[model samples]
Target chain A: MKTRKADPKGVMTGAHYLDGDFALAEGALAAGCRFFAGYPITPSTETAERFSERIPFVGGMFIQMEDEIASIAALIGASWSGKKVMTVTSGPGFSLMMENIGLAAMQEVPLVIANVQRGGPSTGLPTLTGQQDMMQARWGSHGDYRIIALSPDSPQECFDLTIQAFNLAELYRVPVFIMTDECVGHMHEKVVIPPADEIDLVERKWYEGPKDAYRPYKPDTDLVPFMIKTGDGYRFHTTGLTHDERGYPVINAEVQDWCVRHLIDKIDKNAEKIIKLEEEQVDGAEVVVLSYGITSRVAIKAVQDARRQGIKVGTIRLLTVWPFPEKRVQELAGKVKAMVMPEINMGQVVKELERSVAGRTKVVSVPHCGGGVHDPDVILKAIKEAVK
Target chain B: MSPEAKNPIENFLRMDRIPHIWCSGCGIGTVVSSFADALEKSRLDLDKVAIVSGIGCTGRVAGYVKLDSFHTTHGRAIPFATGLKLGNPELKVVVFSGDGDIFGIGGNHFIHACRRNMDLVVICVNNFNYAMTGGQVAPTSPEKANLSTAPYGNFEYPFNVPYLAEACGATYVARWTVLHMRQVTTSILEALNHKGLSLIEVITPCVTLYARRNRLGDGLNLLKYYYENSEVRHGADTRTLDIRFQEKITCGKFIDVEKPTFLDCMNTHLTKTLGEKFRPYGV
Candidate 1:
């Protein structure tokens, strides 16, 4: 679908020094997100702070809700009111948000959530960085559904991918996640905000048919339904239950099948269009290093050292983590001798890589158990081992 | 039925979705009827009025209403309504849900919303138990009240909802029973006109579960009990309004005073701080 230019009112359009969290906020504003409901969680608080400070000038709204559950619930409510909405949280808050994340997905509310990764099963290292929530981002919410998740390796990419996250959210009517770690979230760097007209934003596909004919969940050809804002005279109803096209609860297996399939297929069938990977020199490499978020930056350094040592190593940095980019990984697995994956978590995303590779070649995991990033030498050794 | 011959409130209901999931003799339907009557009486643009509900039997009110409605997750109607109102200040958002949804699992949100005085009308149908879940113990269940979970009789204390609302800074507070249909309608209409967080707790009957478990007979018997036991005490101190097991219920418009709502405070503060540079949101 064709996209529109960002609303100039929200565009900062300048090069400024910012952390990833602040850049994520700017990116959201540029993407026409006018409503942000979030709670203060370390590593993610700066985004909410930035938003609360900036949104008033943009004619937008920012609310610090009572909790993460209310934060996400508010975002869904705001989204239906025809505003692009988002929230930022850390691990604990993300866990609180899962139930409503499932609500947003099931109701097909376009929402963006940024989980600034921190070390944890439960508030383990609040001030430290870890990519531990990678798998949780995919499967945290219960039931069978698919959501788009993007990882940014830098403050600049934080701005870029957050815009993409909102676009994907609007395009697919799904909850999208900006999965960045505390290292990048707190790391200050130069981020350039381009002119509003240059930045593309996907507006919601709003239904404009006769009010009486409006069916809240009737899918268009894209397997995504058009949405209507509340108080638009459509008088439509939408629920979290397994619902029919009319958005009414239908307690039947057939309706459940349709509802779940609609949620999953909207992303799965469009996976190729949604998956984005930043590849460097993978055309003819014996070993490939796959990584995302802050680990991707670390992996690049390791790949450079391996190349210096005469190993044929390439890098594939995942920009879009969910929808997995499995097909590309499978193809690369066929050509490469092995793939080495490094992540801040012990083994979250590496499992996906191993599954996608499917024993076509060796897949190695260089896991870090939170609080810090992977050392370059550790990833280099994994690359060397994969090739050997 | 022909359009003119049909119920006047039919226009405000999804008539096709009738034969609602509500049980026979359930008071939730009466509350809905009163709500529709209130909507009609208010003369507000129906198009701009939105209804939000949390999970449970009363949560289904959103689906049955012919308005832009949201049946959200359990215990989230207030925050969802908060979002809806803040997202579009022009839209009048009302939260219609049960006592368990609003006060049990969602108590924190409820208190905070009242504290902020978020612009919303919360119609809480307090049936004294988690009716939708087979009369389980709820935060508002009366002491020693029989229920599915509290089969022997509930020993826990129940909340005085109006008292909680008043303590949390609600701009308007009222209570009525489903038997007092006209009073419920009037209170709802008054709530819709109030500028801040207005909470109207409607004591209703859950015949299938709450009433049946307590041997309170059918919904009609419960209504008869309400008619006989309810006391009209306008401006009564909210603290004296708790409904004990089979005891007299104090019902009235106990609190009504104006305070700047959440948005009002936001716009006022931001305008003062940011001056002409501030583009007032949703203005």
Candidate 2:
């Protein structure tokens, strides 16, 4: 009961507050969520259940929907109704959600979804943590579009950055993924809940008046249109087709090109702000470790340990993974003599690092694919081997 | 909003897209007549409504309506209608889908939406076969029903529409044959006002697709079959039809429980609780 913090009504946040679970769920709710509908799936089930219970208490709607498709469908429905909605699941549920995720993008529905990384091509390890959906998150559905994804490394990050994921999703009118591994999802730690007034919540930019005049798809100044919920006065018409400025479905080539290009440019031009990464002690360092999420956490510990052993080793950790920070990789790869990448998957992100850092430095992948996360020692070995 | 207007059908329909697509002797035309009659009589504001249709002969319902509409992918009208209703919460959202589209491939989505009792109208035109796909055997196709897939006879048991709907927790469920025009139309109007998952299954005949294969005659004879054999029981057991499960029961209002739907419960909870802890995180 040492860390049991109680609200005015006095039900201690499950694990009873100021703990791992509370930090994760509370972080999302505090970020201005009004709806959540998700089915229970392994590893990520608690996330959905936790939110469903908490949302009713806090005025948000959390629905334990029928299946993964309906779960995400309900999430999309809630989001269109002007709620910062989200759904959480691991492998199988994530796979079922892919088609609707494409629907979300084609229709430009803003949502916050978290795939707490699990071991899988198809239900490989449900209870265990692995970073296999990294590639799938990018190219899972059958279509053409880009995704904005983030990976939080710790329980504290699970709190602080889940809010960031929500803000980014609303800002872009795109589904923002809060990619967390089991290491981060389950690990117990303290997360300071910043005071209520301090946190900034971004509701979708809304139009002022009228049912007839609103073109649901086209926002005048910003490429991302101002979203008006159905109850609101604006009579918005949006579809999953290549729509014109009016948001009515159109199949003409010119409109199709404009819609696709602008949807991408809205992310690309803002890549600098969106693609966040940590450059750790790369100043005059030869060997660098390319990492992200749990692998980055391991690489950070390994980098520190390697430095103690006098191996001029530094690490590059990616916070935002979607618009893969190739420029940073290119810059670091040229300066460093060699880079070692120890990932949970069978070398997905390393190929990108290699593509960017080609011929500049030897890009080596220390990839492992089992159940649990790649340990710090495994990466420490890669660091030592790279520096050797 | 005049109930006795000239051509009540044209008031609800888009006359610009005239000459409907159902084959000349098809019963879908009769169902559409009932739907239009319902819409006109209900007097729902056209500007604030959306008609969502899936890919089928019935999918064309969206294009024929002047209201905001969508002709979406195959067998997804319910989920799409769910999206529109949840998104707007105020719009009079409706789903227009056919037998094969709703009960065959889209069965999972249909069952789930009913269980959720999402606030929307589901207008199911059960022609008993895939009319658009050249009359293949559907999930709701009559037992011993003939189709391209079942040349001899359908071995599988057909799903009774109201049974499946009521069992899946639909707030309001009703059934009527197309020839029972006034009953079917009134059911559609009532469903629109019900404020939850309400299904009005219209038993139509595919004169071009199903009739040629089953030798069930055209829409006129199909209407005769419905008129002659149908037992108008409000609580008939469709699965265990009285005569050894052979009778195709013309059931109605099977389940009309007033359970709190997803939207009703959602709004009530949100309006009460969203104030106490409406704070931002990581500020």
lDDT of each: 0.92, 0.74
The TM-score leader among the candidates is 1
lDDT, candidate 2, A1-388, per-residue tens: 0111222221222332343344557767878776677788777777776776676556545667667877776676667666778778888889988887887887788887888877887878877888888888887877677779888887778777777887788777888887887667777776666656556666666666565666667744556776666545343445566777766555698988988886787777778878888887888897988787777776777788888988898777878888789888887776877899887899887887888877788878988794876778877887777766
Model 1, span B1-283: residue lDDT tens: 8756978789889988988999988889899999999999999999999999999999999999998989999999999999999888999999999999999899999999999999999999988888777889999999998888888989998998999999999989999988899999999999999999999999888888888777889888998898789999999988898899888999889999999999889989999999999987777
What fraction of the correct interface contacts does each predicted structure contain? 0.92, 0.21
Q: How would you encode candidate 1's per-residue C-alpha lDDT over A165-261 as one tens digit per residue?
A: 9999999999999999899999999999999999988878988788789888999999999999988888889999999999999999999999999
**How badly does each model clash, as a count of residue pairs?**
0, 2
Docking level of model 1: high
RMSD of each: 1.2, 5.9
Q: What local lDDT score does residue A91 receive in model 1, on the 0 to 100 scale?
A: 98
